[model samples]
Target: MEIDELTPAEARIWRAFARGDYVDFRTGPDDDPADGAAWGPERTVRARVLRTLLLDGPRASGEIPSLDLSGARITGGLHLQYATVELAVRLKNCWFEEVPRLYAARLWEINLSESVLPGLIAHAVRVDGVLRMTRARFTGLVRLAGAEVTGSLYLEGARIDAPDAEGPVLQLNQAALGADLWAPGLRARGPVRLTGASVTGTVHLKDAVLDAPGRTALDAQSLVVGSSVTAGCLDARGTLDFRGARVPGTLELTHARLSCPGGIALRATSCVIGELWLFGDGRIEGALRLRRARIDSLSLDPDLVPDEVYLNDLTYGALVPQHPAERRLQMLERDGDGYVPYSYEQLTAAYRRNGDDDAARRVQLAKLRRHRRTLPWYGRVWGRLQDAAVGYGFRPLRAGAWLLSLLAAGSVVYALAPPPALKPGEAPDFSPVFYTLDLLLPIISFGQETAFAPEGPYQWLSYALVLMGWLLASTVIAGVTRSVSRP
Candidate 1:
């Protein structure tokens, strides 16, 4: 297409592209036309004309060819599938007639900020520079699966109102970005898929709102990020899945509100995260799942309690702001999976590592109490007895107290009524204290018990004392042995 053969608007844009000048034709921000019907010739450009200039544009010696346009209404399909363009294309504040197709295309930088488009498709495309679409609005699907970007992909302040279709509204599955995938202040009305995507830098989703009721809002399964995924203040209405993700850096969702009523609000099952920080006063309306997740550290707000959390086999190496077991042990009891011993053990080990032996012992006591509920009726009765007598081996001081109480009670009853001396004059002299002591210590028989045989009610009291002695001794030994066997 020669200069004279081109339309006047196209000729002007051609001269600007040759000089690498940015062409803005709209009068003001309010001059945005939904269609080119009301637009002047200066504000209209065919998609083919833009494509032709991008591919065969005149480049000055030692100067890079560029095409930067603003406020232009594109009038046809901008299909760049499998086409290689070396210039940086910036089409800001433009209204596209339809979504562009850049499937498997090798391109340089692409910036479509503040544009209104049906959607975008750049599947399997390779972009040498950054792909930016900040503040752009997409009414349909935005596919970027298998894309390889050398620089970051920015979608800040973008509003995508793509309702549920055949797949996710914003698809970046299996894409590889060399730098960050920054999407702060992003608003999406459907599912945003990032499954199997790899980002070398952080994935920022601060102040984003994602709404996909009764379905997954953000599905980043198997996502491998080199740095953190910070989604502070994110409002996720549906399930946000990060299962199988390997984020060596922290996955910080501080102050993020999650709501998926009657379903899991956030699922990070089997994820290997360096830290999972949820330390703010965030609201969670549904279940939180971390089953089999292994986090190096966790920063949890003591007041931020989830109603239903499945922590079966979930292990964290350390806890931020670690407190005593009284304040922290309630979290282990809140597991909805019902009696996962691993959760208690993991917490116990964490407390021990902090050199808080008192906290560790308290956790052990809680574990036994939780386990007792799963036993049979008879076993539960025995468990209750041991709990009251010695706190399931965690409270050794209670055992001593119970023994002293029983000994004092037995001595008082015997001292009030003297026992009859056996064999008349041949028996030893009666001593109430020694006689009571002899009955209680079943293993050693003192001569006072053998000689002074009690009569009537005193004899029955002696038998009761002997039985109680054996029971207390057995329970004490069992509890002590349990404490010694572990740790």
Candidate 2:
């Protein structure tokens, strides 16, 4: 308790502090020998205030006034009591097997970054100024509930081990974080319960894992996580019950596995999610019970719900239930077992309510096509026939015109071909066989007056041969042209 009674190291550190040497204190982990005996399996640090403040490195022991441990380690716990130190304490890289209780301590900055605190077995730890822990690790439970953290509290990459190796890790039952509770990569081997805890700013749990009895990674109910609750992936096996919580901006559970007693209950009467994705067996019952919830999108895989889910009074940019029927079975159960079908009638009614007939008709047509299987077989066949006829009716006209043009062209070709004998001025026969060629031509060319104008079957055969040869030549020409153009 006296100046000369202190150890040489403690004397030197106290002397430096008295000389206003704020930046210079004991350095290195071996600066204090008190740590080995202070916080081993047995916890006892009977050393007075001046001894601790003077020569204690984080791992070493002995404390000084306003311990400047910006980057140091304490192999033992720190017991700083009634020390009138301005910028009071800084535990930058400190670890503890157990803690030495403090009393009437007025501390300013406490930096516990990159430090492993096995447990804070202290009676009470209090702080006044900023506590910046950028990447601290806690192996045991830390109780800083009633302590007033005036400035920013940063625990960005903190790892708090489960409290009861069987219970929750860090239980902030009634803690009040004034500024942002920035614990982005904070992992807990047990469930992290912040029920009834309040943070003025944001509570960032972006990539933290909360492992507990029921598989819930993090459990916060009646707890206020400021404007947003942004979790990257939550594996909540037991009920991740958020029954009466309120999130302002968004509760993004994009790729979270949710499980509950009956099923997971987002059933927080009026909680909203900007975008919610139900991945791993994410089933919900008791109404996705968002009495007046709002969301950007609610997406879920059809196979995720093994049984049934419900969405009651929920609103979103789009409520895309992978299996809406499952939700209907729970919430909109009218007429015993029923659901709101996405039918033409419903769609038309929606558009009609909006006072848009064009939109109503469009939606009706879409619904008709989508649920076409719901129609009777005869109705389906009739619809198909009508559709096909409307689409390809003009094709038959083109075919008919081509056939008629071909017949007319064949007649002209027959007339144009050199007749066996000229009639001089008579009309040329357009029949399949020219009668002049079979009768008149033969008599005129042979200089014989045939009695009956060659009216025999042989005469008919001669005319048929000429017509067949002409048709064959025309077909061969057309075939040759088609083959040459084909790719």
Candidate 3:
């Protein structure tokens, strides 16, 4: 750590730090240094000097003096892998010729705000304070895989451009953050990945622009967020995948615009969330898949419509809609695919839990209608018959009505017809009502129709009565069976 043992470049860097002067190698003799202020450097420091300073610098107060490399043009890569530093490293407005590699390094805090860098490779790095990169621009991939940060990761107004189309602009797989991941106004030319990451605070991406068409723009599968994942006014041209993610707080996407035609705009399969808010001018051009997701509550805009939506096995405790019931029903009907029974069932359960039995019944009825429409031709026919005769087993009274009508018709026919001849040893008197009843009742016989012999047209009339009676009996049995089996 002695200046005499340090190289000439290291000595110069130490002297500049002692004098509180910002280092700069890109400034010309004719250029006014005062114009650059604290960001302007008198001379450039070698990469080795910077590394040595970070590794062996003396502590000031309780930490090393803040290393200000603002406006400095670094010659080579700054490799701080596994190095421990106790002070803030400020590289504001600097330009890096090579990507800085900080793999497995432990730092107090690092600020690359407003810096133009090739990229950053900080996999497994640990930061005790904020990783501030506000307004910084990256020309390549910024990988932070397995990183642990005790403070927020700020990337406000940051612009990232990756060379590979399929690679992510920012990779944060398995990263753990103690605070919020703030990235408002971020513009990424490639995808942003956060797979298996855990954020203790909210992940805010308000007004961010992501353009990774035909691919995943934001892949946060299996991410565990302690708070909400809010992305208001976001414009994403590709898919936003959140499969198997768990959010204790709401996942808000207010005023967002997502377009991934012929592909999924958002997929949250098997996710568990406290609440979901897709209201306030949000529009998704492709399918929004929520298969097997468990949401405590859902809030959707009355007018918002995605091109296609899949809610198979999606269970929500409530549907918080500000619109009327009719409008809400219409919105539920917006799913491009045919009727899904679980969606209707989930809604019905929600209404029932809210103590609105009437609404729940209405939803159940609607579910039946929608299900009937999706049935095959033969199923439709059977359904219609059941509806007409027994109200799809919902109103068993209708079957009773049919039976009464058939019985009355049989009585009228038998009464108007000529009297039938009685067999030998039979009763002398003949009662038309008793005769009709005997023909109509298939299970029990009063012996009136069996002892009597009907003539010509009367025989045909009795046959008709018997057939009608059998049909009504079968329909009633079917209705009862259905009612018993229904959930």
Clashes of each: 0, 16, 3
lDDT of 3 by residue, 1-487 (tens): 5788665545666766643456545455444222332432334445666787777764444433667765665557799999898777887776677889999999988999887778899999999999999989888899999999999999999999873744798999999999999999999998999999999999989999988988899999999999999899999999999999999998988899988999999999899999988878668888889889999998877666575778888898888863445655665687655687888888878777777766765676567667888889988876777777776666778877876777677667767774556766665466777788778778988768767877888788888888867866676677668667756
Candidate 1: residue 356 lDDT (0-100): 87
Q: RMSD, each candidate, Å? A: 1.7, 17.8, 5.6
**Alpha-carbon error at 324 in model 1, in Å?**
3.7
Measured by TM-score, how close is model 3 to the native structure? 0.78
Off by over 4 Å in 1: 29-38
lDDT of 2 by residue, 423-479 (tens): 434434334223333322322232211211223553454455345444433433443
State which candidate, 2 or 3, has the greater TM-score.
Answer: 3
- Compared with the true structure, the alpha-carbon lDDT of candidate 3 equals 0.80
Highest lDDT among the candidates is held by which one? Answer: 1
Better of 2 and 3 by lDDT: 3
- Order the candidate numbers by lDDT, best to worst: 1, 3, 2
lDDT score, candidate 2, position 293: 50
